[model samples]
Target: MHIAEGFLPVTHCVAWAAVATPFVAHGAVAVKKQLKAQPETKLLLAAAGAFSFVLSAIKIPSVTGSSSHPTGTALGAVLFKPPVMALLGTLVLFFQALLLAHGGITTLGANVFAMAIVGPWVAYGVWRASRGAGASMDLAVFLAALLGNLATYVVTATQLALAHHAQGLVQAWLTFMGLYAPTQVPIAVIEAIVTVLIVRALSKIAVPELQRLGFLPEPAQPVAQKVGI
Candidate 1:
């Protein structure tokens, strides 16, 4: 959910921006290192960014009179890790704000914090944990995308509640959460399925790229036998 321009107070806007700065900065370094180390995956990285941008840009009408959209941050987070998505996600938000007026420049930091920073981290963690527990790649990706999308909304609701909490903080949060859940739930599931499909397709077609990104395990080498005999 892109908070409208000028919706948040100046103090809140500044506070969010300050909090989000370091993550974006770290993300910048991570991107540079990744590109230098694996130059071949540059196109793959661009595809991930495009996926996030296209999905997030398709705003849907929410039951709360606000809008809801898919937070497509999970794919990049799962592929390149959370830090990489942090930068790509921010770039997606920046361009959306500038060109589409989907979000505003003033609230860029808050949007980035929710959609880029927290969402990717949550997705990456879920993906890692699910895989560690022996979940299939499809299952892990599905769970990661679903939870990550929901987490973004939860954080956005928190930000809104904090900014406009004259009616008591807890009440405000509950109200916002209630309004968002109706639309966001189905969208999250859809995003999860879409992510899984994309990953599945990539598994077949982009095997080398996925292996380079560590999405696929490297092939094991055979050992020489009978030499001693």
Candidate 2:
């Protein structure tokens, strides 16, 4: 979900942009290093960004300035790691701001900080934790995407509360989150399922690519059978 144009105060917008700049900068370097090392991943990377763009573009109005939508960021975080996803997510938001008027250029930085940086890291962390606990890839991805989408809304709620804190920060946050919950929860569940399906499909077609990215392990060779002669 995006914070629409002119929805946020100018000072808040600048502050958020300043905070997000370093992460986006680091992400650019990470992306360059990744492509240089594994040029084969470019297509997959593009697909990840496209997936996020398409899903996130489906906005349902919620709250005052924000909306509710599935954030399709977990796939990229799982495949390329969170750093790479920061760039991809920001790019998707940027295009949507300019072309689709979904989000605003003024609010781009805040949106990036939430949906791009915080969301991907949360998703990646969930994925790693779930896998470490011996969960299957599909289950891990589902949890990662679900929790990541929720995390983005939490951050957005906090941002809104901070900007409009007359009723107090905690109360305002609760209000925003309560409004978002009805739409966002179902959307998060759907996003998680869709992310799992995408990961499974990619695993079949992009085994080598996934292997290179450390998302898939190499296959073991067959043992020789004893001769019966």
Candidate 3:
């Protein structure tokens, strides 16, 4: 969900931009370190960014009148972790705003916070948590995408509620959430399935790249060849 241009108050926009700055900065640092460690990550990073831009740009109208779509942050978060994913995600947001007019500059901070930073960070946590809880990679990836998509909508609703704090914040928040949930819930489920598909394809051919990016464990085993009789 994007907060359209000038939709938020100036103060609200500036406040969110301010809040998102350091996280972006930290993400930049993480990107630098990752590139230094695994130069091959650049191509994968580009693919991840492109994935986010393509999927997230396909916004379907929702009850909020704002529209909803897949975040695509789960793939990046699972592959690169939040710090790196946050950096990549912001790039996607900026480009979409600049070239595609999908989002806007004033609301850039708020959008970035919701879709880029918080969503990926939460997804990364869910991915790790699910993996630690002995879930399969498929399940982990699904939960990451599903929960991450939900988290983004939640953050967007909160931002709208805060901006309209003239209305009771709690009521506004719940109202905004109610408006978005119908579209977002189904979008989240679709995103989870899509993420699993993407991960499965990558797992088959990009084990080294995935392992290098820390998505796969060290000493990753090669995919076993299936011999046809």
Candidate 4:
């Protein structure tokens, strides 16, 4: 669902770039801190970046000439922190735009805002909530992935509405949401199931890997109070 360059008006592009700059900067700093805190995480992040790039490229056609694909934010957030996921996503998008031409440079900021910022943060938020309640990790991961994918479309719809507004199009924001939600929701559900299955298998074989990668907290000797995210 990468919005091409020139799809949005120049004004919207400039506005989104301005708004997204600080978040992008903050995300980069967080990634740097993560690398320093755990040097091995750099390898994990690179692997996730490569994985995301490949995953996002495999798309299923949707209405409106858009396509559905795995957001990959859930996997990243489950392996690394959300901020780190954002960095990984940015790198993946950069390479995709450069090599594959999957997305455009001009719309990079908006794409990052939708997929990287909104998706990972949504997943992380759900993960945190579920973990605090001592919910099953598998279930939490599923819901987090589901919400992240759904939120990507929501954010994209908002961005599109904003672009239309700048261009004086008659379409309303709610209208855009209404049109996009029908297509996005079903795909999101499928993504959630896939993510849950993968995480479940990973948890069985490599629980410590999850912990080391910051997906799960260090296990307590007797299992301490539940923590989220």
Task: Report clashes for each candidate as comma-separated counts.
Answer: 0, 0, 0, 0
Q: How much is 47 displaced in model 1, in angstroms?
A: 0.4
Q: Put down candidate 4 lDDT per residue, 35-96, tens digits, no spaces.
A: 88878556566766765677677667767555667787887876776787777787777778
Per-residue C-alpha lDDT of model 1 across residues 132-205, encoded as one tens digit per residue: 99999999999999999999999999999999999999999999999899899999999999999999998998
Per-model TM-score versus the true fold: 0.96, 0.94, 0.92, 0.84
Global lDDT of each candidate: 0.93, 0.92, 0.89, 0.77
Query: Which regions of candidate 1 fall more than 4 Å away from where they truly are?
Result: 225-229
lDDT tens digits by residue: candidate 2, 41-145: 999999999999999999987555446898899899989999998999999999999999988999999999999999999999999999999999999999999
lDDT of 4: 0.77
Question: What local lDDT does model 1 show for residue 63?
Answer: 69
Residue 83's lDDT in candidate 4: 80
Of the two candidates 1 and 3, the one with more favorable lDDT, higher being better, is 1
Find the candidate with the highest TM-score and give its number.
1
- What's the lDDT of the predicted structure labeled candidate 3? 0.89
**Which stretch of 10 consecutive residues in model 1 shows the poorest summed lDDT?**
220-229
lDDT minimum window of 10 residues, candidate 4: 220-229
